[model samples]
Target chain A: MRNEFHADLQTVSQLLVELAQEVRAAMRQATRALLTADRRAAEAVIAGDRDIDHRYRDVEERVCELLARQAPVASDLRAMITALHVAADLERMGDLADHVAKTALRRHPSPAVPAELRPVFTDMAGVADRMAEKIATVLASPDAELAAELDRDDDAMDELHKGLFGVVLGADWPYGVETAIDATLLGRFYERFADHAVNAGEHVVYLITGHPTPS
Target chain B: MRNEFHADLQTVSQLLVELAQEVRAAMRQATRALLTADRRAAEAVIAGDRDIDHRYRDVEERVCELLARQAPVASDLRAMITALHVAADLERMGDLADHVAKTALRRHPSPAVPAELRPVFTDMAGVADRMAEKIATVLASPDAELAAELDRDDDAMDELHKGLFGVVLGADWPYGVETAIDATLLGRFYERFADHAVNAGEHVVYLITGHPTPS
Candidate 1:
């Protein structure tokens, strides 16, 4: 029975890694849709979110069940709790990706990002993608060191996010208010994507060290 | 032993209500600061968020401890799970309020919501404040009916949020890109506050019925 519980726990951990991978893809696709105004890609990201959510719910149910039936103590208990928190962060990351996709769809036919601002978004998306990749890797390995690296990546994302505002709010900005609003919100989406990645990293760090890195 | 476990469970539940109340006050004070351009109010709201976070962590530790020590099953287990989820939502709500306060401070001495668009923000804050209040009441009483009503309030918030965009994007709008950006982000802060409240309400509904609500 104890062996079976460990196997189930391992399955739960595997699902978390898979969930992270899905969120990474969803956000990347959403960024593609945003940059190129590809309706199909946007639709795909929006649609794929349901699958991510399904997997997230699967994690939740398994974790709750393990806590109840296994009555896991100490590190095992922390693992169950961390699985739930990590799954939730992954699920929310998927939603943020969906939000980005929906924004792309809202401005269909014309790119939501202007030509000049596209590179900034491309950079932001690049950082976000790398962060998501690292998130999956850390969740799979529970490496405290890699998780710490994601924080530096988050700082880079924040720098890009701030630069985005500088460009949009620049005195000579050529875009109208509508584009400004879109830029503002889009920047928020990517910034928050990175923030959630950092949050997931924090959870993984806690799982490994049993000492939560201060928020 | 069973009775003692429940007493601890009750303490956790009571903390959830207090959390909801703190969130309500935080958002309300944040709204006041935005409307009045009161730097002190904004600072207070920002500083108060730490207290909210501290309480949130307290709830988290107590729930995790109860789960480890008591190994509650059935409704007791559901209650523990719900408490964690609800506390998280409340904490996020508090953060949203902090965002609103910071927005106000960034525009200090000059109101974040222009005089013309102030009414919409007023209405949004009113809806969010009421939702927070209702969240506290529902958590305290575990009333599915009241919890369900928070969804209606969320819809109201969405409408206000939409109307805000319409006004900002209107051709007659006189504000510059910066104000529009501020309005867009502010609208989002309130909208997400309401979203988190609905999330907490769903958690409560699940706790009461033992049947998960469709997300």
Candidate 2:
């Protein structure tokens, strides 16, 4: 019995999944630019963020309209609300990706991280991208188990983030103040990206379990 | 002809104002901690963030209940949703203040920013506190004009933020990589705090005008 409400909710879920995929690609691309100093890849990520924002707004409008017209019951209401918050998280993930790209651009013709630290940035991005992937997966079908995995990925990101500080603060660090600042900020951007992914995963867990996790 | 819905919504608005004030005080206290290296002040800000998060969650529950029970009309719904988001912004502002406090604590027995940069942080905190005040005022009575002023305040914040980098990057800068990283992150925390305030103000403007400005 696919009524208008069901059809529209389905569409919204699909849109969320697609948006998550877009954000994931953006993160991966930004990391590529960061590791290789690829101006073109960086430019593409920066340009792509607007479309992500546009789609985010589209999701917002749809969710609001759906809530208003359908007057969804309790379960449906929770799903709608969770979708709204997840959309916001996805949009922010896009912004983090954009920040990563800009960091790369700022050091154009120069890798954003030192050669020794490139592996760390790569691993950080890997964890973040994996979290985004799981977020997208859980959105398509609420999987509390799958959603729960993002926390583990986030721990990996934190470890990498801490190791980055170690390198920047190490005595042998010759890059100087500017590079250290860049690395510090870049590390933060990825860490935040991973965090948003984790939050979005929690949103999915709430959707499935009907219990908001402790903040 | 005030119904239960109006009464509940009124309570929500008042709660938001109080939360805004609390967040404002936290930021000011954090700055004091940053400048004076006052361990007690820093510890207070850190401990106080839990209360802020609890209040934020309370607002979220109230808003959801109001929407579900009342099924508010479009205009009222917009206000309810906007309040939900503004509460989130306020809560995050508290988190930023906590970040500032932790930075102060990290360099305990020593200030976070250098002596020369103390004034910059002082001025930045002042503008941020003023912005929080306006947010509280606008929440009490939706004032588009007051909300509009946040953008200008945000511009002032940007100038200060840029000036901070200039000082940090100056050739005569005595602080080495550690202090530079600390200053960079602390500056980012304040800048983000300001940006969230501006966004919250825009949310108020949207509530008043019923037109969401471009993203």
Candidate 3:
């Protein structure tokens, strides 16, 4: 029975990793849709979110079943609980990507991001994609050091988010209120996406070290 | 042993209700600070959030301990899981209020909501307060009907959120970029706060009826 419990725990961990990978892909495609005005890509990301949601529910139910059947304690209990939290973070990340995609769809045929701000958003997207990839790695390996590194990656995203504010708030701003609103919302979506990745990474660190990471 | 487990579950529920009340008060004070530029109120809300976080952690640990020790199944398991989800939503609501308070703090003595948009924001705050109060009631009683009413209340908030977009996107928008950014972000914080309240309500409904509510 102990061996079976351990095997179930391993399966739950693998499922969470798989969910993280799907979320990473969703963010990548959503970013592409936002930057390039690709309606098809945006639609794909929005549609793909249901699959991520389904996977999240599956992993959650599995974890609950494991807890009920095995009643894991100490480190084993922590692992099960952490899996639930990580899955939630990944699901929220997927939703953020969907928000980005919806923005792309709303402004279809005309990119949501203006050309002048494209470079900044491109950089933001790059940072977010890297953060998501690192989250997947941390979930799979559970390395405290590597998980800590993801926080530094998130700092870069924050800088980019602030840079966006500078552009919008500058005296030279030429975009109308509509564009300003779009830019503000889009920047927030990316910043929040990176934040959730950092959260998932921190959970990984906690699961490994049994100590909480600073938010 | 069964009686002890049930008693622990009751304690956890009470803790969540208490957290909900605290979150409601935080939102009310934060909104006041934003509209009136009350620095002291803003500071108080910001400082008060730590207590909310502590309560959230307390509730989370209690639920985790209950699950590990009791191994609750069926309705009992669902109630425990719902409590975890509800506590998370409450914690997030507190953070949203904190965000609003920080926005107020950053623009001290210079109210974040412009005079022209004050009425709209005032209305938004009213809806948010109502929603929060209703969430507390639903948490205490777990009535599916009351929980369903929270969704209609959220509809009011959505209208206000869209009204904000209309004002910002209109040709008559006179505010500069900075104010526009502040308004947009503030509007989003309020909308999201209400959304989380609705989520907590839905979780209550789920807890009572064993059926998922529409997202």
Candidate number achieving the greatest DockQ relative to the actual structure: 1
For candidate 3, give the lDDT of residue B186. 93
List, residue by residue over A1-215, the lDDT tens digit for candidate 3: 88999899889888988998999999999989998999999999999999999999999899889888888877888888889889999999999999999999999999999888999999999998898888888777778998898889888999999999989888888987788888999999999998898888888899888899976
* Candidates' C-alpha lDDT: 0.93, 0.91, 0.90
lDDT of 2 by residue, B38-78 (tens): 99999999999999998998998898888788877687777
For candidate 1, the TM-score of chain A alone versus the native chain A is 0.98
Cα distance off (Å), candidate 1, residue B157: 0.5
Total clashing pairs for each candidate: 0, 0, 0
Error of 2 at A54 (Å): 0.8
Docking class of 3: medium
User: Looking at the true structure's interface, with contacts defined as alpha carbon pairs within 8 Å between chains A and B, what fraction does model 1 recover?
Assistant: 0.70
- Local accuracy of candidate 3 as per-residue lDDT tens digits, B1-215: 88999899889988988999999999999989998899999999999999999999899899889887888887898888889889999999999999999999999988888887888889998998888888888877777897898899899999999998888777888987788888999999999999898888888888898888876
Winner on TM-score between 2 and 3 is 3
DockQ value of candidate 3 = 0.74
Error of 3 at B10 (Å): 1.1
Candidate 1 residue runs with Cα over 4 Å from true position: none
Give the runs in model 3 whose Cα sits over 4 Å from its true position: none
Off by over 4 Å in 2: A1-3
